[model samples]
Target: MVKSGQVSRQAGNNLASVMSRSVAKDVYTAIIEFVTNSYDADALIVKVQYNSIDDTLIIEDDGTGMDQEGIRNFYRIGDSEKIRNPFTAKGRRKIGKFGIGTTLLEYLAERYVMETWKDGKKITVREKFEGMGKGKGPEAVIEDDPGHISGTKITCRGTRFSKTGLDISALKKVLEWQVPCLPDFTVYVNRKPVSKRNLAASCIEYAFDEVIKDLGNVSGSIFYNKNDSEPLKATGIFIYVFGRSVGNPQGFYHLLPPSTVNRVVGMISADGLDDEISFDRGGFKQDSVKYHAVKKFISGVLESIIQDITYSKQKEPPRDKTDEIKEGIAIALKSAESELNKSLVNADGNINKNHPYRLELLLDEEIPWISRIDPKNNVIYINAYNPQLVVYSSKTNPTSALNVVFLTLAINALAEDQVGANNGNSDLFKRFAQTRMEVAKRLFSNFTPIGHYLKQQQGNDEQKAIAVSDVRLNPYRLYSIEDAAKLFGRDIDAVTRLYMAGTLRSCVKRRGIDRFRQEDILSCMSKIEGYIEIGSVSDILFPSDHESEGAAKHVLVNKIIDSRGNKPEYLKNVGSIAPLYFVKANNVEEFKRWYNGVE
Candidate 1:
């Protein structure tokens, strides 16, 4: 029941020429091919050693060695039994289909020695090649090596390694990427073990598999580098046929964009792709329909995985220390309130029940002060005019603004407690005021109007730089009134009123411009009850007396006339010097209507 095919002598000679001409593209690739052969042989441990002194590379493995018939089959180029039966006797898929791997030794060295033992029999073979370009084959000799055990050892001499010898570190990385996940199996180079555990630790992996109608089972893992700065050197999806790696890492050009190439690495195994692979077993045949189908599927899967990663990152909460800050401030506020309440009492010796101490937080468009503690009313008011508070409150979680409120209340409570202890000593009060202002500046530095306003002057190099440096040193440093106005979104006159009220303590006057301390601004911010409209008398009305005494009265009367215009219904004499008009201050809606009709 045996059948055989024969080739002519000329054809055999031509085949030898083809084998001699074909060689591996690189030394590392040639080495990978030989190692992959050992894996197909069901090797448990593969040892590789390079001798720089002699330029020799030795690869040995503890696998099922070949018999005499197997040796003959190995020598037959392009006629491997693996092509007919794609799986080994152990049921493991084979990586080498063509017998070309055996001929790859010619590309690595000029001379080589191979020894193997099987079934109590041993064989030692030696080969010497003239040169690759000569089209001449290796001269071989066979002998018995009875001392050899049940394994295979290949020693390649006169290797074409670089002048400094092999780069063991780089070679180890290549092996780690090319080798599949083999349980209880390890590869050692120069007695050092190469491990995949480190690579796995630095990646986020996801497992995926899809069954295509003509492609059998397609399965693989996608890995994204957790740290982009230190990515794997050979990053891409490594394609495997059977249990061995075939071709260089692929899927870079097709799977993802160029920007993400360094951050992604993967491995895919498609057993049915064996038939569609090239003769050299390096890659799939481009014209094969099965190749395109598998590529398309892998591309789709990779795109989905990338989208999932992006979505997860977007949903992750931003890292911050605001929660810790808020908690500390809350504790401080409670302690300050408790200390201040002890000293605050009525004349009857009982704790003040009518004017109970409380903290009030408010947001007003017209408020000019940062904060105020009223001992008479026992109320602590904080202004929402602070730019820091506005920015923080607008966040998805308004913890930043809440922190400002707690801190401001604590500062005000402490100042009130200090004032009660001092009993109105001017010197002691000044010291207490100084201390309170310093504390407020430090606590609400980021929330201050001046702080936010100065940030907007980024175009002014000298001023912005000085402000930044001062803030870094002490957040409560004095700023000019104009800067404060810009920060509070108020006019200069309103800010000046705060300065005159003594709530805003002046630090120093420079070039006739007063520089108010940040702490003083916060203290005076609460003292501002209402805004006064200040201007010249003529500006307030169209017609007014030029004389000083009656100038104010005439301005007021003209204001009323201008407000009413020349409406005949409201005027008794249309063009007379004295006109009668009716007004209603109680009806706010009616007053607004008349005001709208005014000149």
Candidate 2:
């Protein structure tokens, strides 16, 4: 005969005896777990104390505490009275659902002690860990308690964390986002009260109030912080089920543009999402309908908030491009003017008042060139209307790029004059190379933001440079342009650009062919080896452009050339030798900052 009987599911003794794997993830989680229990008890204030020096953690709260039976349920595995009673006696919605008990305190340390008082009764439980069967079960002792007030306190010694050292600031943020959004409830870390942090320095908020089709009422607020702070930035919106925080989605980074990533933070609470809450409570069940509803709803609103803020910024009044370009030109010229005036350009290889170096920025883009030089006049003509330059000026460091344009072209002009008079590249080691190198160094150091970084790195790099230069056995060594190009992993055009840009000087004439000394080329390579942050010639070579009335369609294609008027040597490999700017200065990003001075 077949027999029918009722069946029930149960967690094994060992399985239910431990805290949920999710709740025991870290000490912070443990703090959150305990704080949450306090909150569920209708505690208005919870204090969390962590003594890194002593490796101790203590959580104390004043609320309706547990009696002896409540203490028994606390140690019981897979059995939470919270599941049966949706609300506490005070009518506050319950936060704890999982009944996995005891292991969390052990996770904190090898030993645990918990105490509580309720209705003139006191119970204290102490648990010690040993090998499975050898471990002592939780020991509860009753004490005299006549005080009307009740509360709970959990204390642990020899805590499991020290490296993190219990960052109270981070814990403050966690308490704000991880716990329920309650105005009356407050959390304190190490006696310092946790408060809303960095939320008011240029902040905006978006609030929502609505009911999901099946997930019950959902309400919350999303905040945007303009402060550039690591601690202030929220990873994402925290999801709360009933009064318990479930997960942080981490969608804030991807939803907003890079400019606003991590600036957004929020919370979404649904009254009925118990089934959707993940086992660990770090997040939610991906396949659950209620979870999907919460996520989609939160993502949609968050994205809208980001778009609104981004759009407002775009709506601000924009400055005239021409005035901006002119201002950049003026600043760049002023920065290099004094040094350029002292440059070795006169007949005596020194300053010449009559022929002082000057930069002439012109909006005349009738010619397709970025720069032009007149030997008669000390003025260097920069086509402020160059189309490609206009594109670069819109970036962070237009003035720095412009300074490079003026200095490189000026050096090339000087090199053409002095080096042209001498037939041998060795003459540079004999005459102008040192002066030219010194002049290049001064001009770069004084003008570009990138130059400052190079100044810092030069000591380290220049020392190693001689070692690289030492690889050349002969002082009279000669390398054809193509040979030098191959050595530096560049193309013929790129090497030629460097030579004409005054970054590399030609050594001597062999069979009517121009050759460069390894030392000259080596120094240039060493300075730029790791400092190369430029790409196309247009990036640094050209940085000005102006629109001509009625000729908006006329786009000038930049073809950079030296003062001698020859095309820039094709750095077909390095993309037009633009990175061969004087001294191969520091990181370009820092240069941009120095040039812009955003602060």
Candidate 3:
């Protein structure tokens, strides 16, 4: 039997060892876990009060307060009572893997007290850092002390808070995307509840049609309200507006859907290693289910909203080879111009003029590229040393608003230079200028009408007009040149032309053909445009073909008279009537032979 004083000294040493181990690790993460534990408790309101005078942090939660036994189990260093699935009624799952988070407070505080009540029963736990190290049992330190409240309140002394002002705002920003909203739970730091007005809020709707196996049961719509609402269950999208749910699917814009995000799934194993092209477009792929879900969501949203105004399939009408080629060229010119103009603005908005950067662009693939900007000086430079495939936020300071303006300008200038190199007159530059003005015009023109429609539909409330951040574009299913070619069985050049033509319509007016002409024509064209939004000349050509001086066909095809002197060969292949004429061939030879012989 050891002496009583010796046993007490040994226990005190053990307690001190626990505190020392936890303090050696990340204290900031421990602070985060304390707040997250409140979330798991289904506590809507978590108030973090830092007493500067006392150098203490008081974290109090209105969650189901713990009983004496519950507190003993939950707060112990080696206790695994709370380490379970998160989808419980109380939603308890320990995010702190090491179970040493409670000890972290002991490192920061000289003395700590936890007072709690549950089911009309109250308990208090108090500890002096040095005393605990002197071999006092955990229960020996706790007692039925007075000043206990209905909820749990943890008071830590000897904390180092406010040598500088507390960054509650920044802390709230990180928490917004992580916490779930139950309408009852609200988190407040320094007596202030986290609000959306302080953070950059984007409520994006994500549509996940199905989930692949092996990723666990992580499928659910996540609506992220400004106050930390859970994502919508059906869409699986984390939506954030002014920080509240403004309805879903019906009220908000989608950022990503399921089909697009799936492409990023799958990891490269050691056996999957190849030659130098490992980082190129086809070389690497994502193996993670979570990444796939996110990628699909982003691609879906961008495809639906970003429109091309110049080429309307119904109004322009798809024709034979020459017309298709011409249309493709026109569309390509417009897209290049639109993209360049935006890049130029981005460059000019930020960065110093003298800052030198190189640009290495591979125009072979259509991928987003990056550009650098110094926002303070409003100068832009190109970066050539770093070979990045996609255009995204800058590495140094990604959140700068000037990054977009700077990138847009640099890219626009580069595009202009590349496209204008061959043409002395700088047709490409001219096209870029025209496309910029056109998009601007279209954007402004639709604003009033759209506002009126929105006012009628969702009311003129600013909240309703406010766009929610959602997964709007899905890249996997995006209609690219390759996809067009595969669908039409055409060559790459032909498909490129089709893409150009399609993009042209994005710059056009949204009004119907009747707005341009006296009467609408060819009912079939109207149906196609209505369903597909691809426009063509078939709407205006059929009825007026014979009446006009053949100027319409010439303007449509950008070509001279055909051998028949009535209709161009290309225009004939567009409608249902031409489907029978262009018979499918076994190979390119047969296709060329058949098309060349068309009268």
TM-score of 2: 0.50
Residue 77, candidate 2: how far off, in angstroms? 2.0
Instruction: Identify the superior model by TM-score, candidate 2 or candidate 3.
Output: 2
* Candidate 3 residue lDDT tens string, 291-395: 454345434444442221112222234554434333333333334334444444556534233533322121211212233233322223332211221123222
| Tens-place lDDT digits, model 1, residues 61-114 | 987788888788778777787767777667777777678766777767777888
Name the 10 consecutive residues with the lowest summed lDDT in model 1: 460-469
Q: Using lDDT as the measure, which candidate wins?
A: 2
Candidate 3, superposed: residue stretches over 4 Å from native: 1-27, 84-98, 135-149, 160-166, 196-210, 217-527, 530-599
What's the ranking of the predictions by lDDT, best on top?
A: 2, 1, 3
Candidate 1 segments whose C-alpha is farther than 4 A from its true place: 1-21, 132-148, 162-165, 197-202, 228-230, 321-599
lDDT of 3 at 591: 34
lDDT of each: 0.58, 0.59, 0.39
Per-residue CA lDDT of model 2 for 1-599, tens digit only, reads: 54589766766545523443445777677788888888888898898998887888889999789997788777776568888887977788888867554557766776778889899988988877664445767788998889657999998877667665777777877787677767667888889878643354234456667789987888876667754533454556766777566776574456667766667667667767877777677776778888778778877886677666665465333656544454465556555554566555444643356756655444433544444444444555554543323223245536666676667656654555455546565444324434644454455443333222212212232223223442332232346665555344553433455564466776565433466655777765664554431322123322345332111111111122111232222211222332233223344444333323421
Backbone clashes in model 1, listed as residue pairs: 369-525, 370-525, 563-598
